[model samples]
Target chain A: MDVRQLSEAVTEKTKVDTTARDVEKIISGLASSSHFWEIVCATQKPFSVVAEIIGALKEKGLVRVDQEGEITLTPQGQEFLKENFIAPRRDYTCPACEGRGIGLEKIKEWMQKFDELTVDRPKAIIDYDQGYITTASVMARVALMTERGDLEGKKLLVLGDDDLLSLAAGLTGMPKEIVVLEIDERLVNYINEKASMLSVPVKALKYDFRDKLPEQYVGYFDTFNTDPPETIEALEVCMTRGLSSLSGEGCAGYFGLTRTEASLKKWSQFQKMLLSKFKVAITDIIDNFNHYVNWDYLLGSIRDDYSFVQVKPKLNWYRSSMYRIETVSGFEKIENRPMPCELYVDEEALIYKPDKSR
Target chain B: MDVRQLSEAVTEKTKVDTTARDVEKIISGLASSSHFWEIVCATQKPFSVVAEIIGALKEKGLVRVDQEGEITLTPQGQEFLKENFIAPRRDYTCPACEGRGIGLEKIKEWMQKFDELTVDRPKAIIDYDQGYITTASVMARVALMTERGDLEGKKLLVLGDDDLLSLAAGLTGMPKEIVVLEIDERLVNYINEKASMLSVPVKALKYDFRDKLPEQYVGYFDTFNTDPPETIEALEVCMTRGLSSLSGEGCAGYFGLTRTEASLKKWSQFQKMLLSKFKVAITDIIDNFNHYVNWDYLLGSIRDDYSFVQVKPKLNWYRSSMYRIETVSGFEKIENRPMPCELYVDEEALIYKPDKSR
Candidate 1:
């Protein structure tokens, strides 16, 4: 009956850190939602931790599982939540910006132009683990960049081009130069062709991150942007390349990290790398800022088997938190070293699958 | 005439890191506003760095300074920004949340109730270097806490409550228990009286952060919030005491940090402590999230003589970014050992005077 006693039981049963507050939070999450992903979203906890918490709750007779893996709190659980006075969370986030301070309204014209340019863009290739965010997201990103004083009159290096971010930055006519390094030759050629046609002044080069950055571009950029693969190896490469390109302290970098692909442990490691290894001060991390469109390959991909996909999400639930970090004193450069072969798939990967043929 | 050449000259003159991008950003900042504080906000750079950059630009004949320390671009600087297409940053942030992604609309009713409760609250004491934020800021903070799943049915601790955050949070009727540790007895009495009359479960104890945390409350909280003094010593104490109160991994902490009082070096130190020392993952850092009302003692304070205060800021420019950090596997508990006597005064002390009589 006591929440702390129940929390202790859950913690002991699962061998995971579960606080008295977490027990109530899980119960509150179940009041409106019965699916695993919904609970995860409501609690904002890691997938593994949520799984453990649910398992422990079920064992305690606080919740019951239905035929489709949907979970609902029992009458006993509801009574406990009421006794504790825990209310279900209400959606209070700004609908216009989705809790991101900058909206797409200011960049409406740019989004229209960008939409037209990406009409025939190449589909996300599984081999490269490529998935691009929406055009409105790209414009919002550009707006954020300008707001942070990172966009205007800066040499920007886009570590990948699947997102076509170089074109978006170039469209502002603000950055002095916009360069993109992408392994996909098709994307490189397409971006180059588009840039040349629109006179956006973007240069897209075919470059794999596994290789060392070219000598000419070392410490050449004022800012770098990347949406690296979720694997630890890919993170290291993207970070190293991005750090190596930044000129000095006060230079900035932007990247996107997703909870769907990277666990809280991975997020911790990424933060450690930024703070301890590179010595950059993370200035801003806006959650769910980058929303990805459902890729065409989702139906046949390994993600189809994910528990959350029992009923395909009707909304765009695939999102990444956008991170903006600035150098303080200086940064330590990480070299491009040989990495493990498996950079596309990790234990927590939900949407990405390995290309066996490659 | 070349921007890169000018940037190199500025670097040589200032003996500080300066990039072409910074040069352009400074020029662009001047295109809109001429005051030093306005430029600092516009560029989002460090105080010392902005001072050095502006001095270098003035020496290079790029900007002209008037008697009141207001700066404007010279004709050459204007021409350079125009030729480089460095547009002045436009105000595109959401007016509702001020770009924090959460607005005050949902909490409007709560704000009115909170407003009535604090009608006769004690004014901030200069001896403690205390200043309170707006009521809307407090509510937005509570909303953000709920959004992050940190509030409901939780044992919450307010480390320093000059802002009376305990009352605002108590108004929600969500937190299981609200405990405030404040050195200001007037504030403690005021908060306790309000909470008691409203049937809100809150307890305020007069406790200074310099002393060790009481044994009974250590590791007994689900969340802790604080707005510490700007000095490094205060930061460590607040962090240590807050960490000591957290139950275990997955527990969260919230705090406010400002650029007006802390430089980029201090910001870097704070990040390293969170990531390297305590090993916590910073989840969200919303810039300019907490706006403070101007204090009553500004006329006689040392800040009155600051370069940016010459014009007497017409708007509320004092603000701090809100940080939400979650524990990873575990955190290294920092002991609240003896701290330095001068926790209120530092090299960047802008708003807080040392109170020599003490």
Candidate 2:
């Protein structure tokens, strides 16, 4: 009856959380939309997926199926569907994918190394107002760690390294230099402490993007990585710093962007802006690499700004695709829009639009 | 270490058994290969899947990885790869599909029901040399069972119901008439017994597809289903029989196909034949719907054929896409090239080409 519990359980059993939600989505969808049942059956295991929902609802006295296998929903079931199913999903599902764990053998070995040196999850600074969703700690590291020639002995700069990707990079003991530019002094101090303790050559600097790129840091690093705020302005700002950090040709940068907050229009514009201006060709895009924990801490703080704030993440529902970009020429810089702007809005802009229920 | 034991264990944990074989595949492939490690990091739970294989091999001192994460096969791993992996996979892998339980929720529950009515595994006739690979019986049945409008009281004809799809269909108790044309006498008798006892309106007839359509049976059925052999002739022949059985317009048929056995060139030709000649528009093709057991009996029979056949189905690797077709006009008959000849060969013809390893 509790779709959230069933969903998380399904994710553990099947490594597929979104499809379990599809059952509720279908039941709710059925109230207003009637589609050819075969459309639902088009999926890999529609029979089992549908049967689970039907059996659950039947056990709860909410739905029933006759001898002809026609499903009939009780009045109670209809009401439940209407109310609960109205909310859309906040995450994406891609199973057997590299991010979901169907990757190379040595990657598994390296990821275990990253996990072995893992630190406690950093506290989300309320002022930053960013979704602090994290996938497996070692998984975060694996994405960049497995980037062989791109990562090894390459001077790397991570903009707003909130998930501690720098530590992941440091664990490899391969980067020529690793720099962490952070607004939070606590994270900076934390990284500096771990870097020294682990003998990983990582330096953490208290930094903000509103200021111009530090002169010495300009075109200094070979690779940059960031999981920026989903907003285009913030993404542009962080990426600009990354671009500025790139020393020359063959330099690379990795950033995380999500389809939820950034629409196709936004993504198109953002991608165009990155490619056309910076000459950093988008080489690869890995889907659903960074799975997020509930950022209700930030959402709870946003109830004062928006009326439509009844919903909360009941499960790990947010993810960002990891994008790998390489510079073709000397990196071009984004024009400094140096307004000390309130970059993030209320929960509306922060949380992904639930309308795209996938 | 036995890869078979490891693969099944992995399937139990992740509902994905493909990754368990990647180690061997990679080892065998390495002789003629140079690759970036990221390729292996692309599957779900890459950390766990790859590690399992690596750890197993390391325990046996069968492989080694350089500090740079480049893998080098030990002599033992090379020998093992050559011996075991040479036989090639019997199944295909869809990165994150549901048939492996990565599917939607209802489908999983329904598959359980299909699994419950377990029948004794039937013997594969070496002369027939049909791969007795089975998908989840209830899962396959559910695809059509859930199609209430299309199936209820429909006159159904299955040209080669060796997987016992007829039994699954009969469980619906909705078909007005169902007939199976199977050369295997044991399966034919088994279905008749199961049908009579269950009061399902299905008749199993001892029929060879090479024969001309029987007079009473011609143009008598509304729907047809088959999993014809991948050979063009057999597929054409069985489909022609299915076309002949279709009573009139609005008739539909379902069949299973494998991308491995039927190459794109073959698929294109087959599709052209089905569309251009048969006049049946392909309505839908749900991929990886059928997972199969290795036909050891037929493969054992193959000892007289290929010398290299050590491969047992370590996991459910073989999958056939379920194709749904409906007659736009009346189903068109193939120009019958009637010949009294051996229709199918040994496992060499029935199984996929060993050269095309997954």
- For candidate 1, lDDT tens digit of each residue in B1-358? 6767766775565344455666677777888998876776766554445666677677778888887878888998888777877788666687776777886777889899989999998987677888888887888888888877678788899999988889999998888898999988898888889998999999999998888888888888889999988777778778888888888766889999987667555787777776666857788888888877767775466433335444555556678889998875546565655554566656554435534344
Fraction of true contacts kept, per model? 0.61, 0.02
Cα lDDT tens digits for candidate 1, A43-142: 6554444666677677778888876667888988777677867777666687777677886677789899889878999998777888889887888999
- What is the TM-score of each predicted model, taking all chains together? 0.88, 0.41
- Report the Cα lDDT for residue A18, model 1: 52
RMSD of 1: 4.0
Every model's DockQ: 0.54, 0.03
Q: Residue B38 error for model 2, in Å?
A: 13
Per residue, candidate 2 scores C-alpha lDDT tens digits across A1-358 of: 7775664554343222223334554454344322213223222122223334445666777765554344566788778755652321111122343333233233455566655655375676556755554545335444443422456546788777667778877876666788888888888888898889899899999988767677778878877887776556767777777787777654667777754444333454565455545555454444455666666464444323222123333445455556666554233554543535445542223333222222
Place model 2 in a CAPRI quality band: incorrect
- Which 10 consecutive positions of candidate 2 chain B have the poorest summed lDDT? B36-45
